[model samples]
Structures are given as C-alpha cells and as structure tokens.
Target chain A: MRAIVWKSATVLILIYVAVMGFLGPVPEREILYETIRNLYFHVPMWFTMTAMFITSLVYSIKYLNTKQESYDVWAVEFANGGILFGFLGLTTGMIWAQFTWGAWWSFDPKQNGAAVTLLIYLAYMVLRNSITDSKSRAKVSAVYNIYAFAAMVPLIFILPRLTDSLHPGAEGNPAFSGYDLDGTMRLVFYPAVIGWIMLGVWIVSLRVRIRNIKDKMYESSL
Target chain B: MKAAYSALAFIALPLFTLAAKYEPVTWDKTFRESGKIFVVVAVVLLILLSVFGYLITQDRRISKIEKELKNK
Candidate 1:
C-alpha cells in the first residue's frame, strides 16, 4: 500500500523535473552552451546511484552483524540497482561530454574514476556467482560489497573533485555554484534526485521480493 | 602508394570543407525558436511513466501470487 504512494510520487516528481528541465532557464556559458541543461538528467543519476550504493553498504554491514540471509539479499539487490543507475550516469555523461568536450569518452578523471568504480562492483557480482553455497556467497560478497562502496566513495565523489578534469568542482574549476546554485535548476534537480532514488528502491524491492519467493519455492521442492 | 595518396586527398578535401562549415550551435530562446521540445519531452515522459506504472502493477500482482503459493 505504501509502495503505491511512493511510486506515484516518484512518477509525478520525475515528470515535473523532465517538464521543467526542458523548458527551464539556464545560463549559457561559452563552452557549455545549451547542453548545460543536461545538468538536470546527468547529475541526478549519480546522486541516485550513490544513494542506492549507500543503502547497499548499510545492508552489507547489517548482514555481517546479524548473519541474516535476507539482509544479504537486500544488499545484493541494492548494489544491482546502484549498478544499473551507474550505467545511466556514465552513458548520459558520455553523451553530454560529446557536446561539451568534443569527444564521447574522453579520458576525463571523473570518467575514468566512474569506469573503475563500475568495474569494482562488477567484480563483486563475479565473486557472488562463483560461490555455490548461499551462506558463503552471502558472507564473502558482503565483505566485497563493503570494499566496493569504499572504493566508490573515492572513485565517484572524492577523486573527481581532487584531480584536474573537465568535470566541475575539481581542483581549479567552479562547479554548479555559478548557475546551478543561483538558478531555478535546483527546483527540478532536488526532486529529480529524490524521484530517481525512490524509483531505484522500487526496482530493488521487486527484485528482492522475487528472490525471496524463489527461495521459498526451492525449499518447498526439497 | 600513388593511388592511396589520391584516396587520401579525396577524403581530406571534403573533411576540410565540413570542418570549415562547422559552427558552434546554441539553443535558441525557449518559446521563440523551439517550444516543440516541451511537447517532445512531455510525450516521451508520459510513455516512460506508463511503463513504470506497469512495473508497479506487476510487482503487486506477483506479490499476490507469491502469497497464495506460500499459503499452500
């Protein structure tokens, strides 16, 4: 029941963001030009992906402490959602870069960092699938998930800011502060992050439910 | 080598012309040159939302079936 309301709200909020972002006023910087409006879609995907990964990390910690299989399942599914959003973030960022930087996949610090971050999580998936025992898989993958999230923090959030890159807020560059901070971009940006995160949760919830049912069916078969 | 040079020259001429014609494009003032973007965004977003709505309904339906299976 509550899920229904949450999903509805997510839909409405995203629609608002899409509508506003398309029509909203944004400053046309010399280099960025009209493509600066991509700020609405691209930035929010990282926010949503980071939020989901944090949830995944928390569940990984809980799984370690409680040794509950359900917590482990939740951790895996949350990571899955994070990975899915990360793909969206990377591809959208690439497209935006093509317009602004004259290349689709320039070796930007942020871009390389994001690729490495995705690779770390992909290794986590590989680790999970290689183990046959559910308990061992859960335990081992929980540890890897924690490490993956730790790497993600620096990879996506910190390293990009520390190094020189085309991305904003880096060593010498100004970020969203110029236009994004002052403009009505936030009116849509904030809700867009919230909406995308909620949608991620909705997706994870369905996957988790399906997994639980599959486990139940397997046990019954035994 | 001579034929390859001709092929290279053939490619280079059009490429240079294209590069010369390339201009930095900027979006026009909204509602003046193109408010049609709003229409396109609205149409696409509606389709995306409907698909999302279907996923929600599928989640509920699957949950119902799971409950019935568990009860048995």
Candidate 2:
C-alpha cells in the first residue's frame, strides 16, 4: 500500500511537470525557446549528479571511519551512479551549447573542468580494479574516492571562473537571474528537479541492493 | 584522504564559478544543425560505452570468481 502511494505520487508529479513545461509561456525567440526546453532535462541531470556524488562522498567517509567493506561497496555503487548522471549532464549541456554557442565542445573552463572531474572518478575505478587484496582495495579505493571528490570542486567550480565560458551564468556572462524565470516556469522547473533527484536516489538504491545480493551469493559460494 | 579530496573539490566550486565569465555569441544556422547532430551522436556513444563497460566489468568479475572456486 505504501509502495502504491509512492508510485502514484511520482507519476502525478511527472505529469504535472510535463504539462507545465509544455504549456508554460516562454519567449517566442528560437534560441530562448529551445534553451527553455533544455531546462527540463539538463538542470535535472546536474541535480541528480550532485546528489549521487554527495552520496558517494558520504559512503566514502563512512568506509574510512568504519573500515567496513560494505561501506566501500556502497560508495562505489553511488559513484557509478554519479558518473552515469554526470555523463548525461555533460551530454545534455553539450547539446544546449551546440545550439547556443555554435560548437560541439568549448575549452570553456566549466566544460573542461567537468570532463576532468569525470576522468578523476574513472581513475578511481581503475585504481580499484588494479588492486587485488580485498581490504587493500577498499582502503585505497575509499581514499581515492575522497580525493576524487575533492578534485571535483576545482574542476567544476574554480577553473571555470578563471576563464570565459559560453554557458550561462559565467562571471562576465549575463546569467538568468531570479527575475528571468517567471513564476510559471519555476513551477515546473523546481518540481522537475525534485522528481529527477528522487529518481536518482531510486537508481542508487537499486544498485546498492543488487550489489548486496551479489555479495551474499559470493559469500555463500565461498 | 577521500575526505581531503572532497573538501578540495568542494572548495574549488566557488572559485571556478567566480573565474568564469559568460559570453554570448551569435550562432550560425549550419552550426546549429551540425551541433544537434554532434550532441545526438555523442549522447548515443556515451550510453553505448557505459553499457558495454558495465557488461565487461561484470563478466570479468564473474570469471575471476569462477576460476577461484574451481581452483579450490
């Protein structure tokens, strides 16, 4: 019964967002119009990525404190989900950039920074694979996860500010202020973000459950 | 160590945001069309790569465990 309510609530929220997004009043200008549509997907992707990264970081810290393999597994699963969402965010951002900036990719600090952040996480995974001892792997990977998360800050935030970007809200660029979004648009945008974030958590939970099940099977076999 | 890394990353966000300046450029028609194609292809490739990578990782882990069990 609780599951039914939760499912129905999610469905209703999605429906509301869809209707508001499509029907909301937006500028008739082609660029603005198209970019507006991107808000529904692009912003949500970022939110989801942020959520997963935070989850990964939390588990990484927990593993470091407890020295438990389960925490390490949770961290890895969350990081995997984070990377998936990050890639989706990058793709969506690139699509928006192409239409708005007339380029597939720009060395814009933000763009390059995001790519570097992804690489750092990839390196963490590779490091995990290269290690053989279970305890050693967990310890080293947890350490790497912490480092990767730390590196993400400069890549995502610092480098972007030192240079110019085609993306909105850059230092010199005129960004969309609160006034830029009408109440109607906000109605859809905020809900979309929440819904997408919820979806991200759902994915992470499912992955963690699968990992736990697999671990159980492996242990039984042993 | 992971906490240190996370702290550094988080700290960099504000600085990066401060350094970034946004500049709007006029996009040409050809650029817009080609950009769309590029984005679509990139997205598809990313999805494919992720799926393939996951499968390979799963296969490698399963085989490694199987080998270990057999040896035992």
**Candidate of highest DockQ:** 1
Score chain A of each prediction against the true chain A by TM-score and list the results. Answer: 0.95, 0.90
Residue-level lDDT of model 1, residues B1-72, one tens digit each, is: 979987997989788668755745444475524667767786978887887878878787888978899689
Model 2 Cα lDDT, one tens digit per residue, A1-222: 664465445555655665555445554344564466577668777777878888899998998898988888889988988898899989988888888878879777788888889989988889999999989999989888888989997778666766667666566322346544556667777888887676566556556766776776788789
Clashes of each: 0, 16
Once fitted onto the true fold, the runs of candidate 2 whose alpha carbons sit more than 4 angstroms away are: A1-8, A27-30, A172-176, B1-72
lDDT, each prediction: 0.84, 0.72
User: What digit string (tens of lDDT, one per residue) describes model 2 on residues B1-72?
Assistant: 979987997999688666644533333344334446456545544664564356446545655765665576
Alpha-carbon TM-score of each model against the true structure? 0.86, 0.71
* Candidate 1 structure quality by residue, lDDT tens digits, A1-222: 776688789888888888777777776567776677777788888888899899999999999999989999999999999899999999999998888889999899899999999999989999999999999999999999999988987887788888778888785433557554545777777888888888888889989989988898899899
Tell me, by TM-score, which candidate is best. 1
Ten residues in a row with the worst lDDT in model 2 chain A? A172-181
